[model samples]
Target: MPLFRLDASIMPATSQSRALADLVESEWSAENPGAAVVRRDIGSEPLSATIWREAVTGGFAAEADRSPAQRTALARAAELADELIEADAVLLAIPLYNWGVPAHVKTWYDLTYTDPRIAGGALNDKPVVLASVLGGNYNPGTPKDGWDHATPWLTRVFRDVWGADLRVVQRQFTLVGVDPAMDRFADQAAEIKAAAEQLAIEHGRAIATQVQSLAA
Candidate 1:
């Protein structure tokens, strides 16, 4: 089985989201030893931000009437979409930036969505694990409640739009130890991190089990 993994962290060396994703991926790999894993690091190798606009226009234009840029953009969109379409499962390691989705992730989704296969629900029922992290707390009753604009949007796209069997693992207060101002929450942060890590392990094993059952 092929697994498609996308990392949207600009700082992979110290990315909490990537750490969680690693757990999930390791379990999947253990279950299917030597399985192919396709990786796309959009944060480091970002897509052309302008390509999405060109792709949209290209979709409306005739082949002969399309500009060179438009043709190239459309082709790129197809390539991005093909990766997910061909995958048996997917893992997205994304961190909340500025209380919302990273610019690179947004651009990637925009360009990929222009592809007909994805728009037609090619990812329907595909298993997707989204490992997301936040530097601050945003739970209900907290000061930042409802401030996270990334998780809900991500769920909408994956579960509602793409029809994926999505499982989300989120870790909040990631900056508790790193940021001096949040030092007061060290104990709470540790607890949250531990719980999230455990969830990551469980979700990873579940994904592997689910995929193996389907293959059987």
Candidate 2:
């Protein structure tokens, strides 16, 4: 079985989201070793704004009638679509940047949306692990309550639009050491992070069992 992992963290080694995702991969691999893992780092390599225009133009025009730019755009769309369509389980690891989903993630969705091969029901209820890391808390009663725009938009895209079966593992209050302004909540950050990591490991185990079942 193939596992598709989409990592949208700007930070490399120190990225909490990516670290959690790696745990997931490791747990899943332990269950079924040698499974192929496909990695896509959208933060480092983002889809250009021009891809949208190309995808749109290519979508409207026939293959033979498409311009070189349009063809390239369509090809890019296909690349993304095939990743999800071919995966047994998907790990969508992302960081909430400025209370919003990363620009590359949105652009990726836009590009895939225009492609003909990847339709509304393309994923067919594929299991998706939504591992999200947020710098600040957005839970109810918090100062930034109801301020999260990233997870919601992703919910619409992964659940409503693509019909994926999503399991979200979110870590909030993550700006403990980075932003001096959030120094007050620094004390609780370690505990919160540990809990999230444990949860991610559990979900990863569940995913491994689920994927193996599907293959059986």
Query: Each candidate: what lDDT?
Result: 0.94, 0.87
lDDT of 1 by residue, 11-116 (tens): 9899898999999899889888999999999988999889999999999999999999999999999999999999999999999999999999999999999998
Point out the worst 10-residue segment of candidate 2 by lDDT. 115-124
Q: Count of backbone clashes for each model? A: 0, 0
Q: Which lDDT tens digits does candidate 2 get at residues 1-216?
A: 899999988777789889888888888889879999999998888889788888897888877999999999988898899998999999988999888988888898889877666675887678899999998889899989988999998988888888888888989888888999988887688888899999999999998899888878
Candidate 1, which ten residues in sequence have the lowest lDDT sum? 201-210
For all predictions, the C-alpha RMSD in Å is 0.8, 1.3
- Model 2 spans > 4 angstroms off: none
Q: How close is candidate 1 to the true structure, as a TM-score?
A: 0.98
